[model samples]
Target: MRLSDVWPVRGVELRHGVLELRPMTEPDLPTILDRLPDDLEMDPTLPRYAALDPGVGRAVALVQGYWRAMGGWSPQDWALPFVVRLAGEVVGAQVLEGPHDYGAERVVDSSSWLVQQRRGQGLGTLMRAAVLELAFGHLGAVAAISSAYLENAASLGVSRRLGYADTHTSVLEHNGRQLQHLRLERDAWHGSGRGRAVTVRGVGPALPWFGLDGERA
Candidate 1:
C-alpha cells in the first residue's frame, strides 16, 4: 500500500467483541486518563519516556503535540495516533508512526492500560494484535516494535504471546531506580506463533509511507 495517495481513518469495530480505533477528540482525554494506572511505569526503552507518574494528564498533552508536529497528512506522510475504544468508550491509546522524516520506514507501538476493575481479561492481547494488523496491513510497516520492562509481567506476557522475541535488553531509569528492558523487533514478530490469526483490512496506500529514499538501517 502507498501512503502518499490516501490514508484511512474511522471506527474499526472488530468482531472480538467490542473495539474501535477512532480519531481522538478532547472529550476522549478524560476517559483515557481515568484508565491509566496510578503507578504507571515509564519504561525508558519506549519513546514517550515517562509513565507510572501522577501526570498522565500532562503525558496526553505531549502525545497530542508530537503527532500534530509531524507535518501534514498527505495520505502517505503522517504520524497517526488513536484512542482505543471499547463498548463505546475510550480505554487506551495506540500510536502508528510512519511516512517517517528520519528514514524510509514505518512502525507502530501499542501502549495502553485498563481501569483497575478491567484488568486480566485478555484485553491487552486482543488490542495489541488489532493495532498490529493496522500497522502491517493498513500502514505497511515492515515490522512493528514493542518494548516492556522486565518487571511488568502482564505487558511482557502479551508481547510474548503475540510472537515478539527479545532483540536486546538494556537498563532504564524511572523513579531514580534502574529497570531491565527488552526490545522486540519485526523478524521475531513474523515468526511468532499467533501471527496468522489477526485479520487485517484496508492496506493499499501505505507503501510510500514506509518507503525511504535509501535502505533503512
Candidate 2:
C-alpha cells in the first residue's frame, strides 16, 4: 500500500500553476538535501532545519526531524514540512506548524527557504501563498503568522504581498538580531485574493489530523 493510504498527511498536496507543495517523502530527502540553499547564514533563532550548518550533519538531522514530526503528530501540535517544487524541480522547503492548544487558538505559523539561484523569481511568494491557502482556506485557521530577520527583505516582501501586516518586532537574545513578525487574519486572506487560483487535493482525509471537523473553504 502507498504510504499515503495509512498516513493521510502524506497525501496532502497544494498546487498553484507550476509550483507545488507537499509532504516530503523518503525518496525526496536526498534530492532535497542536495538542493538546499547554500549557506545564507540563517538566523540562529530560526527553526532547526533552517538554521543548521549545511553538509552531512544538517542533512542527517533533517532526516531524523522529518521522522520525528511524523511520529509525534497530534491534534494539539503538528507540523507539515513541505518540499517545494517549481515546474517539477525541487527548489526548497516550506513548513506550516500548529502549536499546542491549536484547536483553541486557531493560529498557524509558517517558515520557508529557497535556494540562492531561485531567489528573485517570486517562487517564494507563490509557494508561501499556496500554504496559506491550505491554512486559511481549508484548515480553519483564524490567523496565519510568520517571522523573518529584519534584514531578510525577500521574506518580508512575500508576507506583505500576501496581506500580512506588521504585528511586532523583537530581538533574538541568542544573536541580538531584530526579528519582524507578521500576521494575516482569515478575512484579510480572503480579501487579498492571493492564492485564488491555487488548488488543493487529498486534504479531505487529512482534516482530522489538522484538528478540524471539516474543510472550511
Candidate 3:
C-alpha cells in the first residue's frame, strides 16, 4: 500500500488561487531547509522555539523533528503539517494539531511562518485561512486557538483579521527573559473576507484517520 493509505493525512491538500498548502513530504525537506533564513529579525518578546531558530543547528533539528512527527502520528494525537506554496514553489509551512478526542473538545491550534522576503504581503493570512477552512469547515472544530508574543504585531494582526478574540495572557521564559504571551480564540470564523478562494482536497480519504468517516452515511 502507498504511504497515504497508511497515513491518510499525507494525501490532504488545500489550495487558494495560486497558493497551495499540502503535507511536507521527504522530497520537500531539502527545499525547505535551503530556504531557511539566516536571521529571522524577530521581536525580542517572541518565543523562540528550537525548530524556528535560524542557522545550521536549527535546520538539523527541524529535519529530525519533522520526521519524528511523521513517524509518531496516531489517532490519539496528531499534527497535520503543510508546506505552503505559491505557484508551485515552496514558501513556508502551516500546521494544525489536535488530540484524537477533538470531536469532544472541538478545538485545534495552529502555528506558521513564512520566508522573510515574503513577509507583509498577506500570504500569512491567506495560509492561515486555508487551514481554518479545513478545521472549522471540514474537521468540525468549534474553536481555534493561537498565541503570539505581545510585541509580534504581524502575527496578532493575522489572528485579529481572522476573527479571533483575545482569550487570556501568560508569561513564559524564553532565552533567559520573560516573554508576554497573548492567547486568542475564535469560536466563530465567518471567513476572512480577503477574497482568496480556498479548496480542500483528499479529506474524504483521511476522514477515517481522524475518526470522522464512521459518522458519514
Candidate 4:
C-alpha cells in the first residue's frame, strides 16, 4: 500500500501556476541535499546551523530534522515540511507549522527558504502564497502568521505582497537578531486574493489528522 494511504498528509498537495508545494518525503531527501549550495554561508553564533563540517554533516542534520518532524507529528501540534517545485524542479522548501491546540486557536505560522540562485524570481511569493492557501483555505486556519529577520527584506516583502501586516518585533535569541512578526487574518487574505489561483488536493483524508472535521475536506 502507498504510504499516503495510511498517512493522508503525505498525499496533500498545493499548486499555483507552475509552482507546486507538497509534503517532503524520504525519497526526496537526496535531491534536496544535492541542491544544497556548496558554499553555504552561516553565522558562526547560531549553534544549530554552525557545523564544524558544513557540507555532509550539515546536510545530514537537515534530513534528520525533517524525519523528526514527520515522526513526531500529532493533531495537537504538527508541521508540514513542504518541498517547493517550480515546473517539476525542486527550488526550495516551505514549512507550515500548527502549534499545540491548533484546532482551538486556528492559527498557523510559516517559514521558507529558496535556493540562492533562485532568489528574486518571484518564486518566494508564490511558494508562500501556495502554503497560505492550504492553511487558510483548505485547513480551516483563521489567521496566518510569519516572521523574518529585519535585514531580510525579501521575505518581509513576500509577506507584504500577500497581505500580512506588521504585528510586532521580537528578538531571536539564536543570533541576537530582531525579526518583524506579521499576521494575516482570513478575511484579509480572502480580500487580498493572493492565493486565489492556488488549489489544494488530498485534504479530505488529511482533515482528521489536522484535528479538523472531515466534512469540509
TM-score for all predictions?
0.65, 0.89, 0.83, 0.90
Worst 10 residues of 3 by lDDT: 177-186
Candidate 4, residues 1-217, lDDT tens digits: the string is 9866789898898999889888999899989888876644332332354445668765766676687678888877888899999878899888898986787898999877888889898998888899888888878899988888898898899999999999999996756989899999999888888777998888888899998867451
What is candidate 3's lDDT per residue for 27-120, written digit by digit as tens?
9889988887664333343234665435766576567657766777765566787999998878888888775466567677887888888898
| Model 2, span 1-217: residue lDDT tens | 9756677988889998788888988888889878765564433433465454466556666677677777888888888999998878898898888876788898999878888888898898888889888888888889999998898898999999889999999998887989999999999889878868899888998888887866565
Task: Indicate the TM-score of model 1.
Answer: 0.65
lDDT of 1 at 207: 39
Q: For each candidate, what is the lDDT?
A: 0.55, 0.83, 0.73, 0.83
- Model 1 RMSD to the real structure? 6.0
Error of 3 at 159 (Å): 0.5
- How well does model 4 score by local distance difference test? 0.83
- Candidate 4 residues lying further than 4 Å off, grouped into runs, are 37-51
The candidate with the higher TM-score, 3 or 4, is 4
lDDT of 1 at 118: 60
Model 3 regions lying over 4 Å from their true place: 39-54, 99-103, 174-187, 191-196, 214-217
lDDT of 2 at 73: 87
Best by TM-score: 4
- The superposed Cα distance between candidate 3 and the true structure at residue 96, in angstroms, equals 1.2
- For model 3, what is the error of residue 53's alpha carbon versus the real structure, in angstroms, after optimal superposition? 10
lDDT of 2: 0.83
Give me the runs in candidate 2 sitting further than 4 Å from their true place.
40-54, 215-217
